[model samples]
Target: MAIISIANLLASYKSPESKDMWERICKSIGSQMENLPTLEGMRKIVTLSYNHLHYYLKGCIMYLSIFPEDYIITKKRLLKRWIAEGLVAEIRGLTLMEAAEAYYNELLSRNMIARADDPKWTVETCQVHDMVLEVMVSKSLEANFVSLVGGSYEGMSYGSIRRLSIHGGEVVSEGSRSNKIATSHGRKNDIQVMNMEHVRSLSMFGPEDNMKMLDRLGELRLLRVLDLE
Candidate 1:
């Protein structure tokens, strides 16, 4: 029999919709309001906050969903990829990376992503909370902004590859299994897999040795970002 007031709820939630909903509920209760917030109520607040974000910021956040949960995201790499994907807009005589960095800081202020410890004070890394990652992944899939290959992360059915990301060593073909190698690089060679011509951004995690699949990296002509780390 915990008693909670509309004012207290308002203080706890930032979304105006949540505040209004509580106000109406409180009025109906005639000062007898005393109920815990439901999961759905919390979801609505989060949804409201997401829907109200600037389109640019929304894209930035959704792009983050491509990474695995709790992944230590490097701000430098993220900014570079965003710029390469043409997701960042140049502003006020600032470079694309500079502008993108501003957007990153803004997301930090909004609590959409958490900063990681940086002894150098560069704030070069960050991570999305588990709940926030779920929301972003859902929205990204709905918009077909990104497609996840094989991974432990939740994603929809495979579709035409636009921005492709493979977690773990899944994308890499082990030693003899992927004997076929394209010798375009003349270094180690790359794997000849399915058509990746349409893919714009490619992110691969796990061992670097597995990266020698496609003989040369230039084969992905449309590729804007090639994140191997």
Candidate 2:
């Protein structure tokens, strides 16, 4: 399945020679198969696919990092969030929603995300593969695109949090005697004092007990998206 997906992705390059393109695609498949045994290798292939995405599509897909693994995201909801974040731009002949739909379709065609199976979900709804989500999280961190707290991201620190996603965990403030805070997973995470003045979006997922984190909302003077689920 991964091989076929990679082939489809490479085909988008539109080289003049079909035979040459097929040969390159075959080589890429073989390379990916060889590296499939290692997580790092899988990430490399996912990164390769991601690097080929359109610039706008790149940001739109990376935004998926904010979602928890296996979350069923409605197409309409996703598109609206993209528009809210200003990730969707006005195209020559399309409205913002239409352009956003195009971005979603492009990602689907490239096999970057998968359609959700629930009958209740609309045909356009989709979810990211766990592997793809991992790559997105890594890329989002590398670019400082989003600051993810809790879960496996505990103890992580960033210079300036442009966007924040709290995945059901607690963050200890600097005033505390202990820098470590207990996460939902029963792990102690070393929290840090970060600059949130530039934060444009914040999403929190978990129990109301975590509402204590909202005390810092006053610092986010530039916040645009505040989602609590």
Candidate 3:
């Protein structure tokens, strides 16, 4: 005859377990849904759809992994690869490239993928929210995911990792600033000070020093939307 308050019950649940549930449910909605995070009440702008976004976005993005991490992706190249990977369906007159581009653009409009820092999406970066990354990493780790890094930053020592995300900083050396990227591959790419315009909402409240690395941090190209950021 013991009853626990709903709030108390949720509070008692482990942080890792709660986070894992969020990842699974969100992903079933949309691959980009994993890019969105709920952290300390902070919010972000990203794509959300009730349709078969999971299948569409997942196929579209995972196909792009043919390129390396931090590799600048262009619209044409993405479409070409998707077509080659059979990500695009064969429509009568619409070439596979066209279908793929349309799919990419749709995801972009919803903020699923960002427009590159430059035109042509050639230099475009694929970023997801940090909370999403945490959830992604947690999910992978729960499933024994382990990621590989090429930099010099000292990587995390945690075992039973199911996935890993890499960014700008390299393996740390004796407490150096390196491994910043590898340390938190599960993060949102909050942008700031783009020559005075396009400041990300996360930047509004973040301390200047804390924000220093947003621009410099690298991207996890090998991971698909499944890893969020």
Candidate 4:
């Protein structure tokens, strides 16, 4: 039997008032540990503990780093690493590998690891639960960890937009600054120059049609992913 499964069972199988009986039950099953079904493999493993409800919940997320902090964590690798980490609590008759598998399955069953499909599973482009990311970024930002912010929008008084990205067939002109042309209805054209140096990520989609804005972004210098799109 694995220590972690034993740990988990010790952790959940019985309440403090029943620890003695639980340990006795574990000893009886210890020899069969190698063949026992994991919580993940079992059809059901209900919650029995009344304390620290989040022990399992939070534990599921601790290994999230296997995927990029902000990247969509794939189920395959996520499960693989979870197994490799030995984070699973031990059950009397289960191997650590077996226990970790059960723990993973349990997490999936509880929605601790839910649908987190990224854009084509692209690590850099993948995403996660907003609340999860929010919680993560809140802590990260407090530590001054910066991230990517994409696109262009011209708004009132041009607030604090420090970066500007001009993509293929897309143009955002500076108010009366360039003689760029875009024939249209019956209104005089207006442009807005977004701040290009203050925030973090400034991504350009593709096709560098407008080289004029290059200077604006070049000033950013801290640019991360400047795709030509």
Q: Best candidate, lDDT-wise?
A: 2
What is candidate 3's TM-score against the reference? 0.39
RMSD of 2: 6.1
Per-residue C-alpha lDDT of model 1 across residues 1-229, encoded as one tens digit per residue: 0122223333445676776765664464443322326643444444445665678989999998789767888888888888888889879889888899999887776677788886755657998876677667767767778765443431224445678776644333324211111111112212334456678888776464345534546667887678776
Kindly report which residue stretches of model 2 are placed more than 4 angstroms away from their true locations once superposed.
Answer: 15-29, 35-39, 120-124, 169-192
Model 2 TM-score, all chains together: 0.81
Count of clashing pairs, candidate 4: 20
Sort order, TM-score high to low: 2, 1, 3, 4
lDDT of 2 by residue, 83-116 (tens): 9999998999999999999898888888898889
Could you say which candidate leads in TM-score? 2
TM-score of each: 0.66, 0.81, 0.39, 0.30
Q: Write the per-residue lDDT of candidate 4 for residues 108-186, one digit (tens) a residue.
A: 4433345655556654222344334333323322223322121122122223433233323333454421111111111
Which residue pairs clash within candidate 2?
none
Better of 1 and 4 by TM-score: 1
Q: Whole-model Cα lDDT per candidate?
A: 0.63, 0.75, 0.39, 0.39
Per-residue lDDT value at 135 in model 3: 34
Name the regions of candidate 1 deviating beyond 4 angstroms. Answer: 1-41, 118-123, 153-156, 169-195, 208-219
How well is each residue in 1-229 modelled by candidate 3, as lDDT tens digits?
0011122223333577687655554444343325544431122211122122446655564333222233455666456556654567876888777777778866655443555565545454554333323333333333334332323322334442223333323333544222343355432222231121211111111133233534433432332323212
